[model samples]
Target: MTEGTSNDSTSDHLSNNGRSCCNKESTNSNILDAVQTSIDSLANKEWSNVESRVLVVYTGGTIGMVRNNRGALEPKPRDLERRLRGYPHMHDEDLAKEKYPNSPFLVLPLYKEKHCIIYMIHEYSPLLDSSNMTCDNWATIAKDIRSVYKMFDGFVVLQGTDTLAYTASALSFMLENLGKPVVITGSQIPIFETRSDGRDNFVGSIIMAG
Candidate 1:
């Protein structure tokens, strides 16, 4: 009787262990299935339908500066837009002509996700150097963002590097309850230069804003 009891107990213990192993395998399979489903969903997703409209606030920064007659870097209105239009990475002329003939905005080339990024430049009148950025200027920037808050998905502020941080910090406090992204960036070297950091910085900022 004692031997029979021990044998039955051992059999029950083995049965429970087998069930636990099966349960673990089932759980792992479910997790893998879930992960694969998510991967397939993203892989099959249509990204072209998505578009990001970014408002570029050109606030007279080194990125947009050009040498004047005296060889001093000065902000030139509309020059930045012209230069961007010529840059293959920044603008697609064919795409602009095909889809956005009437629009003044530029289209970024289709990249990894094939999502379209349309950006319009709003240049500040008499752009000042970063050192000249004042409280009033910050207020104006905030108000400009507020006025078109609903129109665009995000905003990129291109300012001089001298006071870029200060302007960013000031805007943070001035623009209340802002839900959209606001990117402030500038390069030590002008974008017009052959070897300049502005290209990457501007492109990255636009992507981030989008």
Candidate 2:
């Protein structure tokens, strides 16, 4: 009788375990379904009114360096913009031509809620390596941002990875009463190379700036 009782208890336990497993799976499925529904609703929603303008201060960095005749990486003027234009993920030339023909800025493809992000690249006259960056340069960048503070929703500063932390720290102290977002980024490898981190770094910075 005790053995039979023991067997019955085991059966009941197994049945309860099976139901518990099924309940957990059902709960997980419901959560997944709810997440999918939210995603679908967001995908279908109209985001025509949302727009962002960002100012990209291209202050010479490894991100835009190109190979020289000697096969050494060096900062090249106007190269970054050209390369960015060629990258479809970075610049939406079609959209720029259609709606912002007269604008000096480039448009990013509609993403996340279909919001448009238009950005202007202000390349430095003489791009310098981050190792050569000084407090004066930081001041110049701060002033530039101040000059166009009202024109953009956010700011992105592209510089060399070397001394990036120092530049960021300097800017934080220089730019007073700043209400807008300022994103500083750089890549270890030159953007001109086939395998470079510049694409992701720049794209992320642009998105954060916007």
Candidate 3:
């Protein structure tokens, strides 16, 4: 009687174990499928097959700032994209055009015959300023670049100069086997101003990144 009772208990435990394992596997599979669907939806755009692809990681800084209701400069989300799109000189559509009579082009300037920059920005939400940067912030920036390192020809880091020196130094060690250019720059003034260092820094970084 005692042996039978022990056996029954073991069997019941194993039965529950099997069910729990199956449930966990099903949950994992569903999560994976959802992730894949999201990735496919986001990356469905056709590529131009540009030789040079630069990834600009806009962490945040003075360059992307504007005066808020408090009358103080603060980083605005997505404002960098708006500013860049509006500034023809910063990203000249004419420059991106190939010499050929009919061809599609963007803002990037063609560097050699085939080394034109086709870049994308990955801006952080609630952009960080140089002063507020921490070790984790540096890690995030380094990891961001590492995640898509192979896909790009170069990288441009738009960050505040206040802590740029330390951040750059940290990245040098964190990023291993770097075979491409990684240009880090920030403007002393806001890009929205008519006469600002932002234009030069931005344009220069793009050219260098390409």
Candidate 4:
């Protein structure tokens, strides 16, 4: 009888051991950490990867806006991470917070990622719509790019799609590098809109950099 009790205790111990091992194997990786890893691998550990740096000169566009309670569009200044999800940084509003636990990219017309430093030089102006854009703005934007041109491997400009052609043409005259890539793109509809044509073009631009 004493031997039988000892055998049962051994069996229970083994069963518990098996359950503990199973629990660990079944544990899931953190979603944010996994996403960050994917971004890293895609970047190849240069800085986040190995070789080059891409820059995004976020020079005002529909890509960084939000509608007010009264339904007016307004600028929502944010970093690349929050912009990818189309939300403000450290926003505590319930609706805003809920809308962006995931990625915040808009369906804006021009969000292509290229191979270089992702620098987003912004417009001092609150609104970035092309209709409200001007020649002086273009000149100023070009001047700024020239100033910081040395700090980056490449540059991507975010502007109103309606005026991307003009800005791109203007910037071409401004740049002297004869070196890396300089891509400009924008959209008619807001990228977050249902009718937005932004996703593929933006994604395509990112792949182009690689």
Score each candidate by Cα lDDT. 0.69, 0.69, 0.62, 0.45
Name the better of 2 and 3 by lDDT.
2
Tens-digit lDDT string for candidate 2 (1-210): 001122223333323333333223211123233323322332222222337877788889889898999999888897787778887888999987766655556778878967789776778877878898765677667656655555567889999988999987766655534556889999999766889899888888888878
Q: List the residue pairs that clash in candidate 2.
A: none
Return the lDDT, model 2, position 98: 69
Worst 10 residues of 3 by lDDT: 1-10
The candidate with the higher lDDT, 2 or 4, is 2
Worst 10 residues of 2 by lDDT: 1-10
* lDDT value for model 1: 0.69
Count clashes in each candidate, considering only residues at least 3 apart in sequence or on different chains: 0, 0, 0, 35
Model 4 alpha-carbon drift over 4 Å, by segment: 1-49, 79-81, 85-127
Candidate 1 residue-wise lDDT, 29-125, digit = tens: 2323332332233322322333787878887878988889999977788688888898888999998776665566688887666778877787777
Flag the better candidate by TM-score, 3 or 4.
Answer: 3
Give candidate 1's total backbone clashes: 0
TM-score of 3: 0.69
lDDT of 3 at 100: 19
Candidate 4: RMSD to truth: 23.9
lDDT of 4 by residue, 142-198 (tens): 444444444445556667777777776655544433355666766555555555665
| 120 Cα displacement, candidate 1 (Å) | 0.4
Q: What order do candidates take by lDDT, descending?
A: 1, 2, 3, 4
